[model samples]
Target: MLRQSSRFVVNRASAALVGRGRRFSTDLPAETGGDSKFVDDWKKVIPNLEPPKTPSAYMKPRPQTPSTIPSKLTVNLVLPYDSALSAKEVDMVIVPASTGQMGVLPGHVATIAELKPGVLSVHEGNDVTKYFLSGGFAFVHANSITDIVAIEATPLDQIDIASVQKGLTEFQQKLNSASTDLEKAQAQIGVDVHSALNAALTG
Candidate 1:
């Protein structure tokens, strides 16, 4: 009776172990040859991967826009007093007008304007620089060209501050002793010219 009861217990334990093994096999991944459908259906249920981040479109540098009206005429830039500026572009001229600074580019309307004594800022493409002119009249044509007839054009780099100051002092003395309207006008022009030169130098 005792041997029969021990045999029955052993058979029940063996059946339990087989059932656990079957359960474990069903829980394994498909790659391991288990009956798991999870791997096959995973891609359909999961969300798509996102693209990598990129720089904002607004942050990119833009190319320069082409001018609508192109100039056909060739410019001739002349600075009688400064030899260094003779090599600069002849067109797209900037001249100091009597009233203010005037900018001339190609396709500009034809006009003649008086110039004041001041610094003329010239721009060729993105690069810009300045030249000092005492007095001049700028003539612009419809052909997109300009001619600056200047009394004197001085490069700022070539100006001697001490010499300019001396000229200013002498002109001031002449202003004080002016005996005629013409002399006063000449003195005033000299003072204005020197003042413009000093401003360009200091700037």
Candidate 2:
């Protein structure tokens, strides 16, 4: 009886789905998307040894060529759902690093920085675009490529100040009324982010 009842329910549900013309495969998750991971496995860590002397032309320190290509800083800024920036040449990037605010330019040191919730200023020549990021990681490569994977990024103008204020107030209340340590911490984080957004907008 139990087996038959279960089979009948499953059959009815499947029939309803089929009748509605909705075919779904259980193999894949409903909202699957591409990852924004930066892989650097192709980078060579070993230094190449200098070759033997090749007399006058090859061995001699070559004169600087006027036609030489200039080095450019390529910035790839990505969000969870899609890429915000891709291999774009930028003059400077001001990141809100966990340690402190840091500026990156061409030939900047190859290092990783943990970003915080703040504005990321990207400069291209005279124009500067500021993006408010929630949090993420910034990986600077030796070849003048910086990859930024942010949890959430948006411009201050797109974010409604009223909504941020409401969230901040609610989180503050949650923090105050929280009885457990974990709840208070979570609420505190919300309050902090909302506070940061408010500051970014007001300032």
Candidate 3:
């Protein structure tokens, strides 16, 4: 008797859904460019309440992928205070990733790499520029666009080798004399950064 009653209830529910001819909430809304379909329905249900705008209304549309890969990669290197490079097209870029130095070229696969304290190189036709970065991230997009954000970046030529050598020696002494874990860690970081700077300059 209970089974028959349950079946009847389910049958009635299904019949009602079929009879109404209205799509369920799970059904996809028709494409209306960027506007939300829910906003239209909400306005009809509650005329007094203001409808909220969707993120699509505020966000800009992404560029469509081209059939052929681009010849040059568009790069943008940004720092905290200023833009280092903006919309510059280059043949290749080499970044010091945590794993190793990664070389990126045009039509490279999308990737996000964690940077380390090392040199970042940008290669054009005949000229190559180098910069030393403290640390940051590199984002490679599918559209042959690369974005680099660094905590600190200085031109390779501007770095002082003498200062780096002095700091390295001082940090080595501090690391040897450090008694606490925090001190050791701090000294180690200083040593690593100085070492990287020295290597970038000499190597």
Candidate 4:
């Protein structure tokens, strides 16, 4: 009987020890699996850090800074009382040249033309502004600058045609009556100016 009781107690203690060992073994695998999974997840999110790569010959070159050189006509038109027109990047300027009616453009050849009494036309894009200049000197520079020094500049619409015609008739009468060379020459100049002005207004 004593031997049987001792055998039963030993069996219970062995079963308890086996159950504790199984729990330890199962918990160890779960804990280890969770830790390994956490490490793998962190590794996936983290990025490898390195310095940025420089351009190679295979890559296209980046755009460089544009040159500071001017590429348009710079006109400085001035009158005695005020600055008439100071235009940069003007498309074209037309004036009555002593040689003929002339148009000044960007990068034109260097020339100095004496302006006469006519409509001075300044063109920019699609808009044109006309100014009746009595007389002026246009200096064209090779560096794309045009300087217009006008004695008098008035808007084309301001001058009345009737007044110009009356002046023309008076100048013509003065030219016919003049007995001296200087008087005839001066009167002729007046007639020519009035005729040009009339032409400008009508044309």
For lDDT, the strongest prediction is: 3
Q: Each candidate's root-mean-square deviation in Å?
A: 31.8, 20.4, 11.3, 36.9
TM-score of 4: 0.63
After superposing all C-alphas onto the true structure, candidate 2 shows an RMSD in angstroms of 20.4
Q: Please, what are the lDDT tens digits per residue for candidate 2 over residues 160-198?
A: 999999999999999999999999999999998999899
Candidate 3 residue 110 Cα shift, in angstroms, is 0.6
Give me the runs in candidate 2 sitting further than 4 Å from their true place.
1-71
For each candidate, the alpha-carbon lDDT, in order, equals 0.59, 0.73, 0.82, 0.72
Q: By summed lDDT, which 10 consecutive residues of candidate 4 come out lowest?
A: 22-31
Candidates 2 and 3, the one with greater lDDT: 3
lDDT of 1 by residue, 75-143 (tens): 545556543343345445666776666677766666778888877666776766666776667666554
Tens digits of per-residue lDDT, candidate 4, 1-203, equal 45554454465447747845422111223222423433343344433422122223123322221244355678888998898877556888998888888998776766789988888898889988899888889987655677899998888888999999999999999999999999999999999999999999887
TM-score of 1: 0.54
Top TM-score model? 3
Candidate 4, residue 1: the lDDT equals 45
Ranking by TM-score: 3, 2, 4, 1
Candidate 4 wrongly placed segments (more than 4 Å): 1-71
What TM-score against the true fold does each predicted structure earn?
Answer: 0.54, 0.65, 0.73, 0.63
